[model samples]
Every structure is written in C-alpha cells, then in structure tokens.
Target: MSRALFFRLSAPLAALGRSVLGLLAAIGRVTLYAFEALSHVFRPPFYPREFAAALLNVGWLSLPVVGLTALFTGGALALQIYAGGERFSAEAVVPQIVAIGIVRELGPVLVGLMIAARVTSSIAAEIATMRVTEQIDALVTLSTHPMKYLTAPRLLAGLLVVPALVAVGDVIGIYGGFLVSTGSLGFAPGSYIQNTWDFLTRADMISSLAKGAAFGFIATLMGCYHGMNSGRGAQGVGRATKASVEAAAVLILAANFLLTNIFFAA
Candidate 1:
C-alpha cells in the first residue's frame, strides 16, 4: 500500500482506538467507584443526616419539575394519539393507548430526564465545587472516605426515592391525559378514567418503577464520578456539571431500552 494511503487509514484507526480505550478506562473507574460506594453503604460510621439531606435533594425537591413535565407530556401525548387514532377510525383506543404509553415508557423516561437535568447537574456542581475548594482533601485529612461520605448517601437516595417519583409522575401523567381527553376531545370522563385504569397491569407498574431506580442510579453515579474527577477551577466545575447531566441523560435512555427489552420484549 502507498505510504500516504496507509497514513490516512491508520490515522482514523488510531483515533478510534484511542476513543475506545478512553471509554473503557472511564467505565472501569466508574465500576470500581460504584462498588466501593456500595461497600461503604453497609460499613460503620453511617451518616443519617447526609442520607436524609440527599433524600430531600434527590427525591423530594425534584417532584415539582418531574410532575410538571409529566403533566404536560401526558396532555400532549393524548392529543397526538387521539389525532393519530382518529385517522384510522380508532379514536376510541385513545384511553388505552395513553395508559399504556405513559405507564410503559413516557412516565419513567420523562421523570428520568427531568431528574437528570435538575438533580444530576446540581450534584455534579456541588461536588465539583467542593473538590475545587479542597473540601475533598479536608475530608481525607479527617479520615472520612469521600466516596462513603458523599457518594453512598446520594446513590442510596436515588435508588430509593426515584421509584416513588416515577410512580407519582405516572399518576399525574395519567390524570393529565384524562383531563385533555375528556375536556378537549369530548371523551366521557368516567369512561376515559375507567379505560385507563383497567388497561394498566402489574407488569407495567413494576417495569416503570424499575426503570426509575435504574435511571436514578445512573444519574447519581455520573454526577459523582464527574465531580470527583473534575479538574481545578471554575471552568472545570462547569464542564463536570455539563458532562454529568449529558452522561446521565444518555445512560438513562440506553438503560431504558435495555430494561424494556428485559422486562417486556416478549
């Protein structure tokens, strides 16, 4: 092969190799950090206060945004489905379609994205600031493992509370659909409600909450990983925060796809 041709082909190959290596290294680091955090979760010197604060930050405080997103999404989904169904003279299926759509996918995915936007960025920025300010070193000097002190509580809170958020989002989303279909689309309120309720099953509910738990973990872990590894100064903090939310959003979507396959692919 010509030397010039070889250089062109090898340059792109080299870049691809570097990218793959970097990604694998990052994944390995994150995996170890996650395992270490889990180990600390059960060890001595538990911090109830930190855990409680994380619960509030990750779960409770995130409700309004999550709820609003679900509400609006549910309303819009109903209109779209109703219009699409109408084209096929299947408009009566709106209630069932909305119920299935929200419960099986939209509810968890929307809630996850909202939490990623609100919580992931906040967590990343806070921790990155702490790192930049030398608080992580201070924790080490005081014999506190930063992962234990910081990561475990947040991870636990995400795992525990996000499922509840997803559940609430599901309920609120369904209600939003109900309102739109009944009030704007001439759907009988009672019939719409009945169809929605009757169409949902245990599997859908379980799967939705499961996706929430998975998304929560991904969000919190991404935040902590980026924050702990953030470079020095303000720009670093900004980058870490941005990266955390972006990674969380992508991971949540990827996880949702894998989980949906695992739970309902059949």
Candidate 2:
C-alpha cells in the first residue's frame, strides 16, 4: 500500500480506538462514583432532611405523571391487543394479555421513563445550578461532604421509593386496562378481573419492581454525576442537564433489557 493510503486507512481506526477508550474511561468514572456514594450511605453525619426531601421529590411528586402515563399506556395497549387478537380470532384473551403486558413490561418501563424525564431532569438542573453558583463549594467549606449530603440521600431515596412507584403504576395500569376491557370492549367486569388476576404470577411482580429499583438508581446517579461534573457557565449547566437525561434514559432502557433477560429468558 502507498504511504498516504496507509495513513488514511489508519486514521479511522485510530479515531475508533480513541472513542472506545473514552467510553471505557467514562464507565470507570461512573462506577467509582457510584461505589463512593453508596459507601457514604452507611457512614455517619447522615442527612434526614435531605433524604426526606428526596423521597418527596422522587416519589410523591412523581405520582401524577406516572399515573397518567400508565393509564393511557394501559388503555392503548388493550385497544391494540384487542384489535390484533381479532385477526387471530383470539379477542377473548384480551384480559390475560393486557394484564400480563402491563404488569410485566409496560407499567414499570413507562413509569421509569417518566421518572427519568421528570425527576432526572429536575435533579440535574438543580445540582448543576448549585455547582455553577458555588453552593457545592460552600457545603465543602462548611465541613460538609457533598456526596453524603446530596448524593447519598438521593440514591437511598431512589432505591427505596421507585419500587413503590412501580407497584402503584402497575395497579393503575391494570385498572386502566380493566376499564377499557369491561366498559368499552364489552368484557364482563367480573370475568375480566378474574382472568387478569389468574394470569399474573408473583415472579412477574418481583421482576417489575426490580426493574424499577435499577432504573431509579441509574436515573439519580446520572443526574448527580453529570451535575457534579458540569462546567462553569450557563451553557455548561444546560449541557449537563441534557446529558444527564439522555444518559439516564439510555441506561434505563439497557438495564431493563438485561433485567428482563435475567427474569424471563428461557
């Protein structure tokens, strides 16, 4: 090969290598940060006020959006399943299918995504603003640990509360499907409810809640990590906020797939 041709060919390979290295480095940093923050969870000088505020923000304040999303999704899922089942002469299976679909997949996934959009963005922007205004530095100067005060509380709250949100979303979503199946689709209310209840297993509920916890951790961790590492200006804060949401969303989806494989792959 000619020298110039060889140089051109190697350039792309070099760029790809650099990109891979950068990704690995980012993963390492995030993993380390997570370990440190989690370690602080068991340490002294805990912040109850911050932990309570986080629970309120991440769990209580998130219910309305989670409910609306789950309700609409469940209803839509019922309609689609009914319409599709018609082609196969299996419309009678709507109750079982809708129940399984919502509880096993749609409920937790939608709730997690909603949390990522709402809670993740809010956390990222708030912390990024704090970073820009030197509030985090002030905490340091006051003999406070930023991770313990800010990160640990949010992490603990996410781990505890998101599963509960998932449980609520699952119930609301199943109810929405019940409404559509019985009220609009002419399914007998008692029969539909019986079929739904009969079709769900304890393992399905466990898997759904597990996904919720993993997604919650990813959402909050991304927000804290990006916010703490944000640059020093308005533009930087904006970028960090955007990056946090994007990362949380992608990680949540990825984690969902992995968890599903673990829970249901045969």
Candidate 3:
C-alpha cells in the first residue's frame, strides 16, 4: 500500500520535473540562438541582397494585409467607442480614444500577429524545406556560416522593417477612423484629424515603434529557431511552420504586455 502511494506521487512529480527541465532547455537554446545571430550582425561578409530580399518579404509584401486589417479594425473601434461613449455622454472623446488605442496598442499588436501568421510561417517553411533538401548543408560545405548568411539578414530586416510597417499601419488605421467618423458618424473631418493629432504624445509613438521592433524580433526568431530545429520530413516542416506562428504570436503578446507595463506603468 505504501509502495503504491509512493509510485503514484513519484510518477506525477517526475513528469512535472521533466516538463520544467524541457522548458528551461528550450529557453536556453532560444537565448543562445538569438545571441549567436546577433553576434553576426556587425561582422564581416554582410549580404545586402539577402537583407533586401528579406525586407521585401517581411515588410513590403505584407503591407496590403496589414493595412486592410488596421482599416477595418479602426473603423469598427470608432463605431464601438461612439456607441459605448454615448451612454456616458463621452462621445466626443472618440478621436482621442481612437488615436491612443491605435497608436499604442492595436496597431503594433495587430501588425505583429499578422506578421507572425504571414512571415513566420513562410520563414519556417522555406528554411525547413532548405534544411530537408540539404541546402543548408551545402552552405556549410561552401564555408558559409548559415547563421551569418541566412539568419542575420532576415532577423536584421525584421528588426528594421517591422517598425516601418507599424508606422504605416498606424497612419492607415487613423485614416480609417477618420473616414468612418466623417462619412457616417457626423464627425467633422478637420476636427477629428486635429483631435487625433493633438492627443497623441511623442512617447506614445515611440513606444509603438519600440513594440514593433520587439514583436518583429520575436516573430522572425521563432521562425528561424523552429525551422533550424525541425525534424526530418515533410511533416516536420509543417510542424515547424505551425509551431513558429504559434510561438511568435504568443511571444508577441507577452512581450507587448511587458513593454506596455514598462512604458506606461509609471
């Protein structure tokens, strides 16, 4: 009877311990990967063509979807806020609220999630396929450092371009609110624009861009990490792609929360 009880308790404890160890191992590996990739950022053999390609992939190609998502969301937010504020006779604050909301939170988070879904999966799949086909191996055989040639350019592009994407998204989203408010909500175009402009502090804009950079790093890093560690097969590529998106999204959200607190919790 004592042995039975001991086994039951020990089994669960063992599983829990294993889980904790696995999580720690993953964290360590990811940290190491990031450090190694970053170490190559300022090193020799910079690849401008590769960096440009990644910039186009992660930034320019993603503009339409990001703009559309922001446009619709901003329009909806205006409507929702107008309706909700009417109850408290605070409807006139719509411009201020919309500006703050889009710039500080929605724009960065939405853009990040979109990039994770779009860029993260693409990076993971492309890299995983290269890995499976021995392309990465060939790079190594050619005396090329894959981390420097492949990962550095992509990661650096993400770090730079994602902020540009967020800036565009913020403008488009605010424009969306402007359009909806003027057309259907009986708000004056000039007044709405002035209110939005006047209400946003420089700090808000700075934090938004900062969040964009962090989110971009998380998204691309997760993709590269998963792709590099993917198992050997078609199924492995699929799993890596899926896992990259999931991890990127989660990390973006978590990072956003931390950043928000750091930026605003004064």
Candidate 4:
C-alpha cells in the first residue's frame, strides 16, 4: 500500500516536471519567433489598416478605464501623502509628492496593467480564435506574410498607443491628486498648482515616457507571443488568454522596477 502510494505521487511529480520543461521550451521557441517578426518589422508589405485598427482598439478604447484608475490612485495617494506629511508638518508637499508619484510610477504601471488585462487578453483570444478557425492557415496560403499581416500591426500599435495612454494617465492622475488635495486635504488650489509645477522637471516627464514605451513593448509582445502559439482547441484559447495577461502583468512590474533603478540610480 505504501509503495503504491509513493508511485502514484512520484508519477504526478515526474509529469509535472516534464510539463514545466515543455513550457520553458515553448517560451524559448516563441521568443525566437517574436524576434524574427520584430526583425521583419522594417521590411515592406506593412499592414497600415491592421495597425490603425489595433491602435484604435488598444489606445482609444482603453481611455476610460485608464482615466478612472488614475483618478482614484492619485486621490488616494494625495490623502496618504497628507496623512504622512502631517507627521513632519510638511503638508505643503502634497502637490509635489502627488505629481512625482503619478508621473514617475503610477501612470506607467497602472496603464500597463490595464492594457495587460484588457488588450492582452483580447489579442490572445482573437488570435487564438482565428487560429482555431483556420484563418491563419488561409493567410499563409494567400502568399501573405503572417508576421507582417498579423503580428507587426498589433506590435507597432501597442508601441505607439501605450505611450499616449500613459501620458493621458499621468495627466488624469495629477488632476485626481489635485482634487483630493484641494478638496479633502484643505490645500489651496492655487498653491497646489504652484507646487506641482515647481516640483516637476523635464527629466521626470522624460523618464515617465521612457517607462511607458518599455511597458508597452512588454504588454504587446506577451500578448502576441501567447496568441500566436495558442493550441488547437477552445481550452487552448482560454489558456492562452490567461497566460498572456499574467505574463504581461508580471513583465510590466519587473520592467518597471528595472527601468526605475536604471533611471534613478545614484
């Protein structure tokens, strides 16, 4: 009985190990394919229509959620800053803190997460469905480059639109922080604006935009990778969607920390 139980447990454990190895190999293969697609980006036969549609879907449709998230985040941050600042009687620093926090960290990170949740899953699902339905095979048969037709557009669109979304998120977040500071925290509106302008420099804005671009690349790349490599059935499509979003979110966070360290290192 004891031997039988050990075999049963070890069998599943060995299977799990094999599954992990397979997953790593899959990731490696997908990475190479994505790199190839990227190298082909500068080549001809670009899909302007597909790129435009992706841009609209990834950027325009994402505005409302990004705006609301920024607003609440900024507002909460302002309140927290005020509470903490009261310890040192530095309540006057609310606007500056809010501005820096929003522009430097919250904006890019939040927008990235939003896109990962919205755009990554959408792209993965759409592409997986297309694959399951034989549309990708048809494209191949039509003498079209699948990399150019299917991947490049979405990739480029993400690169372009995510930065725009991040900028908008920064502005909305700052405004949110402003609202909470002036309204609930008893800060004078004029003084808050003054502090905000005084504290924010060009370098801060540049760093924010840089972070936005990096996050954008990670989000879209993960989406396209999982989508293009999705399996044969409905279950595969579902798995791809889940995997893409999770990977995008994790990569965004990791990239944020790395970018921050690089940007602000002493």
Query: For residues 23-90, what per-residue lDDT tens digits would candidate 3 score against the true structure?
Result: 99999999999999998988988989999999999999999999999999889989999999999999
Report lDDT (Cα) of residue 220, candidate 1: 90
The lDDT values for all models are: 0.92, 0.92, 0.94, 0.90
Compared with the true structure, model 1 gives a TM-score of 0.96
Ranking by lDDT: 3, 1, 2, 4
Question: Candidate 4 residues 1-266, lDDT tens each?
Answer: 69989888799889999999998997788679778878767789888899889999999999999999999999999999999999999988889999999999999999999999999999999988888889899999999877898888888888888999999999999999999888887889988888899999998898899888888877888888888889989999999999999999988999999999998888
lDDT, residue 197, model 4: 91
Collision count of model 2: 0
Q: Tens-digit lDDT track for model 2 on 222-257?
A: 989999999989998999999999999999988989
TM-score of 4: 0.90
- TM-scores for every predicted model: 0.96, 0.98, 0.98, 0.90
* Native-referenced Cα lDDT, model 1: 0.92
Best by lDDT: 3
Which of the two candidates, 1 or 2, achieves a greater lDDT against the reference? 1
Q: What is the lDDT of residue 74 in candidate 4?
A: 94
Error of 2 at 264 (Å): 0.3
